[model samples]
Target: MTDDTIKEVLKRIPYGFYAITSRSGDDVNAMVANWVMQTSFSPRQVALGLEKVSYTYGLIEKGGVFAINIFLKDGADALKPFMKGRSKNPDKMKDIQYSEGPETGSPILESAAAYLECRVVRIVDTGGDHDTVIGGVVAAGVSSPGEVGDTLSLPDLGWSYAG
Candidate 1:
């Protein structure tokens, strides 16, 4: 297969935008991610792919937990700040209203349409730019009723994280 074919094939896979949040000591951080999927059903596991070098990855490793916040399509603009590789501001959570999740103590954004608190089960080195972190869902909640199917997807933001 050619390079174009590879890119096109990867791009064809559907993805939903999510905010992956982690905390270390008193510090917390959130990053925009699309490579998140449910890997198991019986134990309720989730796999999140994050760049190995990202600050959020370090936090997850150190904290042993994380929270995934799903946003609505209408709130796509609110997630732009998280897309940045690094923030000049010391407190990235300052601009947003969020509360610590009871399960993992990770910041759960109030703006999220739904949220899931997870405990890190294991980390798999993908031997690439990213690593797969498996998490066990401990807690989850939806902000409002009837918000299902209104989540922000990659196409909704005109963004592509695939090759």
Candidate 2:
């Protein structure tokens, strides 16, 4: 298989869109991420493919906590503020409205339909540009009830992150 073929196949894999928030002391950041999913049932763990150099990655490493803010399809606008990387938009979290999660102290966006607060269980080197962050869900909440179909996804925004 060729590189193009591999990218095409990987892009076809469906992904949910989410705002991943992290904090360390006074440093807080949020970024738009799609490479997140549940990894275990017994321990209620979730894996997030986080870029090694991302601001949130550093925060998570120091704070040992993070939050996945799940939005509805109509809440795409709320994620726009976090689309740009911290290097480009240093004050991205300034205008956003959120409250600290109970267990992790991670920011839970008000726009999120639901959220999962997680404590870092491990960070595994994937031998790629991104590292796999396994977090155990320590707390969760739903502000707006909805089905899976109502959740926001990459396709909903005509975007692709996998290759």
* Top-lDDT candidate index: 2
lDDT of 1 by residue, 1-163 (tens): 9999999999988899999989989989988999999999989999998899899989999999999999888878778778775545456677888999998899999888889999999999979899999999999988855444788899877889998
**C-alpha RMSD by candidate, in order:** 1.4, 0.7
Off by over 4 Å in 1: 87-89
Ten contiguous residues with the weakest lDDT in model 2:
95-104
Q: Output candidate 1 Cα RMSD.
A: 1.4
Q: What is the Cα-based lDDT of residue 123 in candidate 1?
A: 96
Q: Give me the overall lDDT of model 2.
A: 0.96
- Judge candidate 1 at residue 34 and give its lDDT: 94
Per-residue lDDT value at 7 in model 2: 99
TM-score between model 1 and native: 0.94
Query: Can you list the residue pairs that collide in candidate 2?
Result: none
Clash count, candidate 2: 0
lDDT of 2 by residue, 6-83 (tens): 999999999999999999998899999999999999899999999998989999999999999999999999999999
